[model samples]
Target: MERSPSAQADLRGGVIWIALGAGIAVLSWRMDRLEHMHVNPYTVPGLVPGLLGAGLVVLGALLAWRTIHGGALARVAAPVGVDRIGDFRVVATGALCILYATLLIGHLPFWLATTIFVFVFTAAFDYKERRTAGTLARGLVVALIAAAATAAAVSLVFEDLFLVRLP
Candidate 1:
């Protein structure tokens, strides 16, 4: 008979996701077919993304329907103590990722850009545990190694194994 604020929030998010997924699927359908290149019909450039978008739409619709069926909006609209700082951190992380993808990827070497991105992300997130004097060095070393390893693994997978081109 009652629901929490979180349920209402999830309902709202599900609607947004549904709309986004539909838009993506539509755009994907409208993309160029590259018929001139004699590409295989099954291997169309938008095939995977379009399918993903459809999947999202279905999943989001299911989520919204589930929330509604659960009577998410039936409860009183009580104020939930929102984590503004955590939200800010999430937004900042997204911005950093966008920067890494758009500005860094094409301009710099793939390995170097990926390494820097991974290292900075790791260090920034782990700052609290690394604040102490004794563990600081160890933390930094670990982060550096992790970053390098991640970069190498990614490079090997995309460049060598998948034969995908990297900028």
Candidate 2:
């Protein structure tokens, strides 16, 4: 039987997700293996990734099943021109945030770095627009809370609990 374009896209997306999940699982397994020498068996480095990978695998499997059995999917309207620019901007902003977190966190204090990261990243995404004030405010609040909680957690886990030092 012939399928609609949306169905074909769903099938393609499901296949892609499944492949990605498989890759993640493989990498997690490899990391787990390598971590054996450094990490105690009870504290496995791959534990989180392994679980996430497994979840992704299951989700991908479900998507694939829906695509195959649920009949033709609905067609989504493509956004006319200029939408690609926003997409690229989002991608670029994410990459920049990751780079800043990975490379600059060492040089700057956690709170200071995180605040700047949040503000700059938010502004980068055009959060200055009137409609975005609420979102930006929410984002800032969440970022602050998350950063504080993360710092406290790390301190408690490494300093008080595990006796490890933070970088």
Candidate 3:
């Protein structure tokens, strides 16, 4: 018997979700194990990742069940369009931002690094309206405030609270 298109799409989505979930679980487990070298033994860094991984695993199981029992095979058979330009731009920008942060962290100081990063990242998404000077002014003000707040929070957490030095 032929299955419906929606059913097939659901099955495909289920498979994709399951695969992603498995990947996340594996990475989370690895991260949890690696974070054990921190000063406090009782302070488990892996807890967050472990919980997230478990949640993903449960979600994957539910998706798989729905795909199997809800007749989703037909939906998975549909043809889909690919948009490579947007995907490439997103990946490239993300990589550039990561590289920028790593290289600038120690050299530029936290406040400068963070301010520049926030401005560049926010502007990159075209969030700043060019026609409205007020909008741009507001965006810059907000970015500066946020950057300062982030720096303060980091300083408080690492320096004052944990007595750890920032790089």
Candidate 4:
């Protein structure tokens, strides 16, 4: 009658995903419809985001349902520490996102802002592992390459391919 840690974790994760997805969906729906631009109906700015949010909602619901059907709530088990992404990581990630969106995006060239954000974020989260392995320098190099590539790719897709202006 007791569920394992994985089951409990799944349930919690599913709920979190559901909540996050719903938030995204609502925000996406509220995004400007570009009525003035008279853009193609299919190219509405929020279409992709709304679809992504809907998918997330569906997947999260499935995860929650599966966990419940598997007897996660049959009986409560003693709380055990779940080795999930720690609270600090979550907070740091949120802070970095806010900084990138607010300070980096509009103030700097899109590519430059993205490059800096990605590099800093990657280096910050990856340093501890690299330090233990005595590869901090290599990690930094890798992070730089990754950041550049990410920026280039995003810029190309959004600006060139999608023809969307970047702030």
lDDT of each: 0.88, 0.68, 0.66, 0.91
Model 1 poorest 10 in a row by lDDT: 1-10
Clashes of each: 0, 0, 10, 0
Candidate 4 residues 77-143, lDDT tens each?
Answer: 6567643567588889999999999999999999999999999999999999999999999999999
Q: In model 4, which residue pairs have backbone atoms overlapping below 3 Å?
A: none
Q: What is the C-alpha RMSD of each candidate to the true structure, in Å?
A: 7.8, 10.8, 10.6, 9.9
TM-score, cand. 2: 0.39
lDDT of 3 by residue, 1-167 (tens): 24334655655676777777777767766664444366564555666766776777678678778777866543445444545666677796987688666887888876667667766666555453642555766676676677677777777788889988766
Instruction: Choose the strongest candidate by lDDT.
Output: 4
**Per-prediction TM-score to the true structure, in the order listed:** 0.53, 0.39, 0.42, 0.51
Model 4 per-residue lDDT at 89: 89
Ten contiguous residues minimizing lDDT sum, candidate 3: 73-82
* 76-123 per-residue lDDT for model 2 (tens digits): 544334356667887988888887779767887654665566556655
In model 2, the runs with Cα more than 4 Å from the true position are 1-5, 32-38, 72-167
What is the Å distance of residue 31 in model 1 from its true position?
17
Candidate 3 stretches with Cα past 4 Å from truth are: 1-80, 126-134
Q: Model 3 TM-score? A: 0.42
